[model samples]
Target: MECCAFCPTESRELYKCPKCDRLYCSLKCYRNEKHWICSESFYKDQVKEHKPELMENEPQPEDSSSKNFNPEMFEDYMKTFKKDTRSEKEKNPQIRVRADEDILFDSDDEPDYVRVVAEKSLEEFEKIDMNDLDRKLTMAGLGGLTDNDEQLEYLYSQLNDEEKKMFNRLADNLQYDEMGLMNSVFGKNLPKKK
Candidate 1:
């Protein structure tokens, strides 16, 4: 029988913390201050997992040329963003206005799943306020560390002034690397029509 990782006792029945894979004898042990960081992270991951699937596998247009952009197809795909339950979007939407950029630039070779993830990450990244410490941590996917003051302080302590400033400036603005993204996936940039 393995002992609980948080409590100093051998346990016949132990549950593993989903985030860290640490054994704990009970909910109390799992929720203890010593284990709260991992527990909190596990909760956040659970919330994300429970969200509805963001996008359906909709068919792409038969034409491969960027000039053949279809507004109806883009509208249908934008509907997938409506699946998000986040209220911030409802209050102040940062919706992309046109199919001119993202949809038109999407490389034919890129998988749908990759494009979906990239779009979601960009939308979420744009919503972040870089000046806020908690939001910054969340944007960095270290939101769970917000609950642990000691860990957060230690993490900051590890960074020198210049690195700290640079980290703080992440996502200060969004710029699409259109040619770079398309070139990497398509092996050449598609020429923009004059």
Candidate 2:
């Protein structure tokens, strides 16, 4: 919800200045002198803070004869640090590709091969008879094992009116997350899944 730092009017669309790290709503605000008064000051402060004497030098190549010559064999084996990562323009050059207008066009729909196969598969599943499906379930050793809440609902549907009232009453009394207390109607040890 933070607005652009340059303008009085609120706006979500903001561009962060690379040098000063300040937000501006538009390119016009980016170039505005009133908004950029401290940018030069920031840059100057940065340079002053990072003076020549304070700068840390990159590790110089060790002399083989120097007494402090720790065996850099481990370092070389691990490649722990990059001795020289700068001057990267001299390393790999950039790749450039020209934009082609002819290659840019929108399709109304995707190529329908996946869609057709999915539809046919769904139709085949729908065509399966319940008796065959039940037989498959029995063969798979899942005849007694019902699916989650859906099978619980199906089991509830098979109860008579009076039994359903008792079931609803018990269900209402029991907490789903933590059944802290056993329902007295169902006795002290309730039928709980192992």
Candidate 3:
């Protein structure tokens, strides 16, 4: 049997989330899944508007001309943004907003299953943040290094032998032709488009 989405060690009896229909071993995983997927999935399904098909006679993928050619018909896709008259609750929210009834303030000594699952997710996020933070802090001292070679030297010295091999592979592309990339951005210092 497939393990629960949240708990891998548990496989006995799993409950399915009503919104997205994801399986969970414990009620806590089911609860946590609510904040992450359930609530959004429920409302999203309810309010989803069916869009009409684009075209019946659309060109096939294998046709080369259809792929390369741009339609000359349209000046712009839209003249103005359509005004969304729906209230805040009707619209897709930026962040997940749980209904008041969904939230349970259970006050027991030990952390509940939902709290454990949420904490685990939080710890993983924090670990990613710290690693990125460390890299930024190290890069912040780059100006103090005299040149690009010196900066590379500092970075290489900081790496282990295993990481040094990866670093060398990354640096391999440093000498490749950059003319196309440079042209795309600077555009051969082209004349201004009127």
The candidate that wins on TM-score is: 1
**Candidate ranking (TM-score, best to worst):** 1, 3, 2
> Ten residues in a row with the worst lDDT in model 1?
171-180
Error of 3 at 177 (Å): 10
**Ranked candidates, highest lDDT first:** 1, 2, 3
Per-candidate TM equals: 0.25, 0.23, 0.23
What C-alpha lDDT do the candidate models reach, one value each? Answer: 0.64, 0.62, 0.57
Clashing pairs in 3: none
Over the full model, what C-alpha lDDT does candidate 1 score relative to the true structure?
A: 0.64
Estimate, for each residue in 26-108, the C-alpha lDDT of model 1 and write its tens digit.
Answer: 88998887876676667756666785253234334444365434344446535434354555435445555453533323455
Better of 1 and 2 by TM-score: 1
lDDT of 3 by residue, 62-138 (tens): 33454444333223212122445785556645545567533233443335776887889999887786556656766
lDDT for each residue of candidate 2 in 60-149, tens digit (9 for 90 to 100) = 454434545434355652353446655434353462324442221234244466688789999999999888888888798677345678
Better of 1 and 3 by lDDT: 1
Candidate RMSDs in Å, in order, are 23.7, 24.4, 21.3
